[model samples]
Target: MGDFNQSVVLEAIRRSGEGSSRIELAEATGLSAQTVTNITRRLLDDGLIREAGRTINGPGKPRVTLRLVPDSRFAVGVHLDPAVMTFVLLDLSGAVVRRTSAHTPDMEPRRIVEAMAATIDALITGSGVDRTSIAGVGIAAPGPLDAEKGTVIDPPKLRGWNRVPLQAVLAEATGFPVVLEKDTTAAAVGELWMRRASADDSFVFVYLGTGIGAALVREGEAVRGSTRNIGEVGHIIVDPDGPSCTCGSRGCVEVVCTPQAIVAQAAHAGVFPEDQGMSDVDAVEARLTELCDRAADGDALADGVLRQAAAHMSVLTAALTNMLDVDRVVFGGPFWSRLADVYLREIPDRLERASATRAVRSLPVDGTVVGDDVGAVGAGCVVLDSVLSPRASALLLGH
Candidate 1:
């Protein structure tokens, strides 16, 4: 309970941004003033928080404002995308202190893990931060992970990664505790942290990346599933007659709403000169970007393909929103940027038309505020969460 109280106070201070007085922290966190004083003193002594200027309240003594020391502790966030690996060093206050990325080597998974450790070492060394200040490392990888065993179970697109114990392996390699999270869920966590001040904190995050996934945020916390693998939306059917999937289903999100699928749609539409499109990650990325650019440039064929993609995506988004009953939807992932212009213009109306709650309330659609590095940033935020988020901190430290 002491740890939980401390977390509450710290989170309050972080959310306060400018800082919070002992009275403010007590009131905000529902802790007694004396308890707030003790917690703040300990936090100050631990260098996790510091006292700023004091404020006097109407004939009372000056109240010292407590603010989080952003650099008091740090965490490394790694986004293990198939095409590239991104690394970010985030301070306790959830600020990115340093960031770097490397194209994922063609080496096997074990060698790639070695490269990841090396890059992490270089990242920390380059930042000039004390090694002891790092709390842990957080990885945002493709989903269907064995969270309890810390294994990646046959993630699509990544070869030779079947039931790999990523958490244990990375921890052994880096000598820091590791937390693995689904990329989509990590992105949602990042969005929640960034939008902590928003009144309505629940939304469905529809992740567009090498795969299509969904994550739910309820109130202000990420709803990680029982297996901690919640957003496995790939097999969810979005188009009944669109495309057949490896799952023996017709028009699953995996086949209809993914970038590769959209690129395939373009290829079939002759949006490109070739009858068949590229199959590699880099080429698929380049083709998707070109398709979006052509759509932006008023090429009717490209525009038609994107609009069709948007329509298919809306089917998926509406299913999530309707089932979750969330009031808003957020779109993001590695491939989100290229399709954002068309998706933003197309999904809202389509979603509204299909929304079950349309008669009761309007659902809003928007992109993640975390931008291109959301996966990395969110992965970092997950590590910081273990230190600052009240519930997560409690779980990490135990009762």
Candidate 2:
């Protein structure tokens, strides 16, 4: 179990934060001092960790402290949206060491896939990190996804993404393992990595992007159902007589709360000038951000439009809290960064008044500070989990 102990030594240092002395590592891991020294030597030779400093522990000797060398390896995360594709490169410590973005190409999947491969190759080469040290790549696209097979299975956001073997294709190009996850789940994972919060053993992440969805994470793993679509909160019919969704439903949460719906409502209210480019969720969000800024600065028309959007969002929050029974709700994606204040103020009130369990308990909602990069950063964390997590790593290593 030399390798296992070595891995544990590295993880212990990481969990202990900045640096840990040899004695600290031995105590923290319940391993012998000689075993820790041996593991640290191998880690140092592998360039995975480096000495941070030395502490004088006794009269005769000083103990060297060890810390992760963030640049030891890199993992990449790609978030695919209709309007823009965000790429993030994270070092071993799960920090975004580099980032790049580009406009999403037309609806052709092949062209978009090729472009993604090219972009990744260029980024890796430019950074000059050894290819072997690249642990894995995580791709967070919309669902319903075939998580087992790593396929994108008919995501409403990407029209032609049906049955696409994105994981295998990307693995072939990058020569590293690829993990495919739903965008909302990625956002939840991102929140976990960023917050390192242990508030609950179980929580739900409400992701507001092109559409609203929830990712239920329990005990450090996302919950996927038999069909691999456990958290499709967007299609949860909140109002049967409301509005028709493209899924042919009358008043699903997505139909009323998506960015597209907000922009459409704003256009109908004579807020935005037109709806040509606002068709894209990202474009609509950018426009909405501008509108929110104007509204916050006292634009009467913009204020009304944003308020309407916030009201719809509030309704969705109330419905989710009632259904999920989750104590903690993490608000994520690009929308949270711009409209978090709006949701934070309006949602709790709505939940208190309308939530089914309001009389029994209070549901606390908070927006993730990780913001727009949450999905990308969370994707990187997913890959790191594959390497470090007990279950995920065992499966990956075929032990």
- All-Cα superposition RMSD per candidate: 1.9, 3.4
TM-score of 1: 0.96
- Stretches of candidate 1 above 4 Å error? 198-200, 275-277, 392-399
Model 2 RMSD vs true structure: 3.4
- TM-scores of all predicted structures: 0.96, 0.86
Tens-digit lDDT string for candidate 1 (1-399): 888898889889999999999998888888999999999999999999988888888887988888889989999999998888999999987888999999889627898899899999999999999999999999999978988998998888788898889999999999998999999999998888777745347899998888888899987888998998898888888889978899999999888888888888888888876655467888888899999999999999999999999999999999999999996999888888889999999999999999999999999899989888889989999989888888843557535
Residue 188 accuracy (lDDT) in model 2: 81
Clashes of 2: 0
